[model samples]
Target chain A: MTSAVELDHVTVRFGAFTAVQDATLSIEAGEFFSFLGPSGCGKTTLLRTISGFIEPSEGQVRIGGTDMRGLGPNRRPTALIFQNLALFPMMSVAENIAYGLRVRGVSRSARREVAERLLDLIALPGHADKRVDELSGGQKQRVAIARALAVEPKVLLLDEPLSALDLKLRQHMRNELRAIQRRVGITFIYITHDQGEALAMSDRIAVMNRGVIEQVADGRTLYEAPRTAFVASFVGENNAFVGTVAEADRDRALVTTAAGPLSGRNLRNLMRTSEAVLFVRPEAVVLGEGPLTGRATEVAYEGILTHATFELDGGGRMTATIPRGAPVPKPGAAVRLGYDPADALVLPREGFAHA
Target chain B: MHSSVGHWLILALPVAVVLFYAAMALLDRRRAPGARPVSFVQRNGIAVSTYLVVAVGVWTVLLIVLPQLYMIDLSFRPRLPPTQMGGPNDVYTLENYRFFLYGSTRSTAAWNTIHLKAFALTILASVAITFLNLLLCYPIAFYMAKAASTTRMRLLMLMLIAPYWVNEILRAFAIRVLLASSGVVNQALMGLGLVSEPVDFLGLDLGLYAGLSYAYLLMMVFPLYNAIESLDRNQIEAARDLGGPWWHIHLFVVVPHAKPGIASGCTLVFMLTAGALAAPQILGGPRTLWFTPIVYDRFYQAFNWPQGAAYAFLLLVACIVFVLATMRVCRLSLGEITR
Candidate 1:
């Protein structure tokens, strides 16, 4: 099918301040797409633009092959789940879920049937008459989703709907959200600042920084092969080094660092023969009595793993997560750190920072 | 014309009352030492309790239930005359109320008839104004509340407040001038070529009513807007997310949340408009009359204080009844409506 949603160089500026810069992406039907960023990073702004709450300053937003520039939110075949999960507190759960259909002028009984089906689908089958405030956070979340789906929009836009819930509920709802998106087979564009939530649920994620998408890739690609130092450090803890690419030929490049020269995967897109940041995932770094050594700055025991932050004497920092039962490194203790050449991806010096 | 001991008693009452209250407060404190610091409590509480108790006791004998009783007693007495009271032969009669309630002289009767007729017209007019004000106020309040910054909202809010500073009478006068026969209003209409002749607004009820409503319309706007403003926009969005359209959002979401504001605005407008004197007197030429004017005539023009007091009392009862009916219809308490 037509890519579920297409944003082509969509730039949204509020006066002189650009909320979303030249951003473009394509989300296929049935795919769960997430825009992941920190607060003020423009993820929600992008989501609002897609939902037609805002118009792009420079380019157009297309959903299912139709331009969405001038359409009002209600006129579009799109629904947005606000960050606050804006449920009508005065309305019954059934009434809230049936809102979109009712607005579309569906007949009463037919709307009821659709609402009943949606309530069942969201797994709140008998909560039709319940007030929104009476339900728990997770229930409110599902009800919001059901409401958005009630309109049967081609794409559903979620602006941090799960952000308000506590950890366990948020975790549970992540899977529920993914399942709902799968069941409905609609494009789901979720905006969130929570890394774990994005990683757990998104079919593909566009990691954003300063109103720009740093990288868009599946969970594995994003985690294992982050294209920029920001993405590498942001997605997970990474041991990075200041280095200049010594040479490159297609896929493998040797980078010279202060500590020593190291072999690494060629981030050809972002690599240049100049001083750049090299990122090795914390898990990818192997610790043993070999190679270079560093002082352990801190250590944390997380039941499943022993994480240690290593301070390089020459320069830079690295984090290594070892099995829980593994020998715990005490603070001030020295430890050797090394990683596979495949784990180290050196990005061009300039692509790493927002400036 | 002064009663010697009674006047002296009234003057001395304040000091005597103060002493009694002080004595009572000391007794209360001795019985119940509160959790607050004793020194602070003794310092503030002594003065506050003394003042409060004395003031309440005196007011009970003065403002509260006394004025009506005094009026009733005076009504029984004849009109001020040296031959009537304690000096000659004091006598009581029901003739004042009888004569005033249904005027004795033809001129008095005509004025009394006009006064009684004013209430129905005022009530109808007030009801219409209140309803329309509620409608107009809701959207403005909603928009003001949603403004991103308090400063921006306050600037727009100043427009409403600015008009308030202009005296109601002046505003009505301004409107009167505009709507006068062969006045600016007619000039504008003629200038626009919409009318062959100048429309006469002076000496007519319609002109009076338009001026009155224009002056009082702000009263309705403030409360209804406050009600709409306090509503959480998120709730509306939530309803919309649930797929609700304009009607559903308004009916199931916005209206219920704003009910208290609407009721409060309506009640206030009803109360003020029913007894309104300023707007009607200034704007309403001769044909449009109001209830307060009737009460005013009885009090001053007729030299019949008892009948005037009775009419005032009747108006008070009408207000209470109107309030009770409004609250009962809304199925809420006055406290809930006001908040």
Candidate 2:
């Protein structure tokens, strides 16, 4: 099957500053893909490029195997949900949904039918005559989604549509958005700075730093086997130990740190004496018995799990999550933290080391 | 003393309303959360607040209300000589108004067609000028509000406003010079061979329309800019993303958002053009006659203050009716238009 959207070496520049550089990727049909990054990471620029708002300074954008050069946004088969949702405040709910169809010269009754069906899809049945401001934030979000889907574009671009909602609502809408994308069965390109949002909703995630795409992978792989130091630090909480490679092999390597020698799987296959950072997730660090030790500086109990922060004997800090029913450590207690070699990876400290 | 009490009674309602709102504002400020314990008197100081209230009251009651009330009273009275004032014949009458219908004619149906024609033409031309100003200013306002950079917008605003610093009559004369039969416009047209003879723009009343539209161009542009500027640009993008073309986007999004501004601008331009005397006088051709000039003749040349007051009051009524009609058509409240 042809890709729903493709970007070939897309580089967007504004005078001397480059917002997105050499972003080449293909979004498969009916797939939910997310560009995850911090603010100013050029994720939004790439989304706008696909939506035909900003033509890439250098590269081609193709939708359904057709070159989109010189096509205005009104002609593109893609719809964008703005960051603020941008619902027409002057329009009623049904009118807002039917706006695109009305622009296409569809009859009033036909447009109303489409609007009612989409409203039902967005779980907003019987809200057709309500004004835009009368709806709640989440309802407005669903309405915005319904309005975008009304156009029936091949690919839907959403620019952090949930960023305006409360935390609980954002999480709830994430699942709702995923479900809607599945029902629509269209390609979804989501942009957000929230890693959890991207991980929770996206089928495949592209992690971006500055203007470059660092890695693209499924959630599990992105968490378990991040290719870059940035992704490892950004995707989830981690305890990073920076050191030099003492010994190297195909699948595992030993790194010499200030505290002692640590061994982990070699994801980047570095040579001996080369600089590397070993990353172990907070949940993977065993706190009872291990070769490395630290003094517990802080311990926080969060119902299901207890988080313990340690001042390492080597001169850094490490955090570990102790599951419920485990003996939680108190401050000033000496604790041993260890991880299985497979759960931790030693990667070349090439990109951003901290989120 | 009895008449003085009656005068004070006339002012009572407005004064009470103003004081009520002031008291409410003070109470709100004091009762708000995190407010300091200072009283209104402590916040504004007794002398300063008193001065401000007194100044505003004096300006409103003395300058604005008194003149309008006097004019309304005079509109109903006869233009008697001072020696005969308050005599046996010094009573309220509608003779000044009836004079408007019959000018100097004895028959009612054989009315003052010339003055009536001038009145009708002035109103129609003012409406046309208002519409022309709206059409001409919308794109410029949209460009300034949405498309231009900050520096460019500032520059455009300066260019639009720089000419207004000159006197209004001087600007009218400038328009007259540019639109005269043998003026620069005709000279250019003849030089370019666009016409065989001078077009006689002033003779055709094109100069008057152009002058009036120019006189109120900023009035239209600023309100439009204010309304359009506050619109979230993402809404425009959202419309386009939904496959709305340019005109459709404007129709569905931009224009709806700009309704209040359009209504206010049109009202201002229409009222100002209808009451304009200087521009008409400066740019009017040999045969051009506007209602305001006739009213001016009643006041100064004819020295018929009652008839002048009557004509001016009628024009004011017409303007208020236009404003009400605009409000009804645009479905906007008075507060929204003024806002």
Candidate 3:
């Protein structure tokens, strides 16, 4: 089957500033894809380009293998849920959902039936007559989703629809959104700056930085084996040790840091004396005796884990998470930290610098 | 004098209510902690509050309420010679109002057709002018509010308002110059071969409509801009994204949101056009007899203040009725429109 949406080297420029530069990706049908980045990082611009609100200055946007050139947002087979949801305050919930159908010349009764069904899909069965302002934040979000879904487009684009909700509701709606996407069986393209939200909901995520798509992978792969240093630090917490490679092999390399020589897996093969940075996940750093030593600066006790920050004797800081029931080091105590060679990633020093 | 007591009481009710509220505010000085925030009177101190109340009360009573009351009183009395000022001939009566229906007795119609026709036509013309202004202004308002950059909006606003800086009478004459038989508009039309002869714009009442519409164009545009500017742009985009065409988007999303503004603009334009005297006198042809000109003839030319008061009161009533009807049709309240 053809991909649900494809961007062929799409570059959107507003005068001299390039918002999305040479972004190319393929989203399969029925996939929950996400574009994750910080604010002004071009995720929204890319989404608008796909939705046809904006035409890319260069390159083609294809939906279901058809080039969508010169088509407006209304002409495209996609709908966007704005960051504010943008529910029509003057319209009833059902009317808002049925607006797309109404524009398509659907009869009122048929539109009502579709609205009722989508209301049920969003678990808002009896809220058909409620005004948009009558809904709570999360309900507005579901209504926005339902309104987008009502068009029955091949792809639904969401621009951080849950950013306004409180934390607990946001978390709950994340699962609700994922479940709705599953039941609808249509491609969902969600944009968010929240890495946790992107990781929790997306089937395949594209990590973007400075208008560039750094890496696209599944949640697990993106967290564990990021291709670039920006993605490694952006996706999750990490302790980065900047150093030069002292020795190299096929899969492992020894990097000489200020503290001592640290050995890690060399994903980007580098020869001797090449500059590299070794990345170790907080959980992967063992607190007992090892090659690296530091003074424990601060210890924070979370429910399931205690995070210990260390001022490294080598002139940097590192954090380690001790699991529940493990001994967390005291602040001001000298501590030794280590990580397994397979758990650490030594990447080239020059990787994906943010503009 | 005895019958006027009811009118006096009707006039006093608003003043009484204001005083009662002020007294209540001044008396409710004792308060529990955080029971409620201090009243305006207490917050500003009693002297300052009283000063403000007295100032507003004096202005309203002297400037607005008193003149209207005197007009109402005069409308109910008969016109008389100076020698018979307080005589039985000067007694209160409905004769001034009955003058409007004088010719009815000679004809089958219920009222004097000439006067009534002029009044009805004046109202109808005002309504038409209000509608024309709305149509012409909605697009400009929307463009200024949503489409134009700040500099462009400022430039458009300056262009719209600069012409108004000249006196209303001067502007009407300017339109007269453009719309006369041998004016530039006719000259251009004849030059372009659109017409073989000059169109009688003033005789056809087209010049009057254009002049009144121009006079109140800002009144319509500003209210509409204020309303449409506050509308979340996303709603329009959402409508467009839902496959709505331009008209559908405006009808479903923009128009409904701008109802209060539309109502306010329509009310202002309708009232102003209905009551306009200068523009009508300057631009109106000999054929057109607007209602205000009749009122002016009664007061100044005819020296009949009672009948003029009656006609002015009737016009005011019509304006009020139009305002209420507009509010009802637009499903808005007075507060909403004012806001």
Local error of candidate 2 at A62, Å? 1.3
Q: What's the lDDT for residue B191 in model 2?
A: 96
Model 1: per-residue Cα lDDT at residue B30:
82
- Distance from true position, residue B197, model 1, in Å? 3.8
Docking class of 1: acceptable
Q: Is candidate 1 or candidate 3 better by TM-score?
A: 3
Q: Give Cα-based local distance difference scores for all models.
A: 0.77, 0.90, 0.90
Candidate 3 ranges with C-alpha deviation above 4 Å:
A271-274, A351-355, B1-14, B17-37, B103-110
lDDT of 1 at A56: 89
Q: Write the per-residue lDDT of candidate 2 for residues A114-232, one digit (tens) a residue.
A: 99999999999999999999999999999999999999999999999999999999999999999999899999999999999998999999999999999999989999889988899
Regions of model 1 farther than 4 Å from truth: A258-260, A269-272, B1-113, B147-152, B237-252
The DockQ figures for the candidates are: 0.41, 0.85, 0.85
TM-score, prediction 2:
0.94
Candidate number that wins on lDDT, 1 or 3: 3
By summed lDDT, the worst window of 10 consecutive residues in model 3 chain A runs over A346-355
Q: In order, how many clashes per candidate?
A: 5, 0, 0
Model 1 lDDT tens row, A314-354: 66777889886777778998888788887678776665653
Candidate 3, residue B60: CA error in Å?
Answer: 1.8
